[model samples]
Target: MNIGIIPMRYAKALFAFAQDKGMEETVYAEMNQLARSFAEHASLKTILDNPVLKSKEKQALICTAAGTQVSDIFVRFIEMVLHHKREKHLQSIALMYQDLYRKARQITIGSLVTATPLSADEENRMRKMLMMDKEGTLEFKATVDPEILGGFIFGIDTYRLDASVATQLKRVKNQFMDKNRKSL
Candidate 1:
C-alpha cells in the first residue's frame, strides 16, 4: 500500500501471470485468504521472514501447512517466489493482487469515517451519493471514528473529503481569528 511502485509492478505481473495460467480466480481467492491470514497471524509472517531458511523450504512448509485449503497455483506462486528469492515480499504481493482483482471488476473501495454509527437509511443515502458521483461501480466500507465529532470523512483511493465537525470547528476558529485581526 505504501510502496506504490513496487506493489503496482508486482500486482501487474501477478495479474498477467494468473490470467495466462488460467488461475486468476483461484489466485485471487488464495491471495485474499493469505492477506487475512497474515493479518490474523503476525508470527506466521515472521516465520516467512527467516533469512536462514531457503525460500523453497519456507514455501514448501507453507504449502504443506495450507494443504487443500489453498490452490495449486497459489502453491506454485509461492514456490516461484522462493525460487526467485523474493519470499520476503509475499505479503505485499498478496495485497497488491487483491487490489488488482478488485479494480479489474470496476469495484472501487472506499471508506467512510463517521462520528457515530450510521443508520441503515443514512448509510444507503451515502451510498447513493457515491454512486451518483462514481465514474464506475464501487464498494464502500464505513468505519466509526468518534474523533470526527459529528459529520463524516469519506476516502476513496488517495482522495479524502473531510466534512467532519473537527474540521468545521478549526475553520470557524480560523475565521474568528482572521476577523479579529482585521478589526485590530
Candidate 2:
C-alpha cells in the first residue's frame, strides 16, 4: 500500500469524525502541533517508528509528547494509528486533516512577501482587499524579503501574484534576448 494513501484516508475519516463532534478547530490545532512536534523532535520519530517498540509503549511515548491540551479523541486517534503501525505517516495525516478542515470551513490562507514591512494602515488595507472577495475567513500573513529588491509577491494556494522588481527585470531580460536573437 502507498504510504500517502494511508494518511489521506485516515485524515479524511478523522476530519469527518471531528466535524460530527463539533471539534474541528480543536482537533486541527492539536494535529498541527503534533506534526510540528514530530518535525522538531527527531527522537520522538525514532521511538515511535521503531519496530522493536510495542504499540502500547509507542502510544505512551507519543501521549507524553502530545501535551495535555489535546482532546481525548485526538489521543485515541493517535493510539489507533500506533496500533495500526502507521506512526511514520502521522505527520502527513495531520497536514491532510488541516487541509480538509480549512476547506470544509471555506477558509482562505495567503501570504505576502515584500521588500519591507507594511505600515499598519497598509497592511489593514491589503488584508481588507484580499478578504473582500473571499466568501469566508481569510488568514493572511506578511513577511519581508529585501532580496525581492522592490515591490511584493502574494500567493494563495496554487495561485501567485508576482509584482517584484526582480521578476520584472527577468521578464525584460527575456524579451531583450528574444529580440537580439531575432535580429541575428
Give the top-scoring candidate (TM-score). 2
lDDT against the true structure, each candidate: 0.79, 0.86
TM-scores of the candidates in the order shown: 0.71, 0.79
lDDT by residue (tens digit), candidate 2, 31-84: 877777888988877777788988888777776666666787788898888878
Q: Model 1 segments beyond 4 Å from truth?
A: 1-9, 36-45, 54-57, 60-68, 133-135, 167-184
Residue by residue across 1-184, what tens digits does model 1's lDDT show?
A: 5556665677688789888988888888777777777787788778888888776679766664444477776777677777776666777888889888877767777789988998999888877887776677777898898987998898887789999999999999999999999999
Clashes of 2: 0
- Per model, how many backbone clashes are there? 0, 0
Model 2: worst 10 consecutive residues (lDDT sum): 60-69
**Model 1 vs. true fold: TM:** 0.71
Query: Which regions of candidate 2 fall more than 4 Å away from where they truly are?
Result: 38-47, 53-68, 166-184
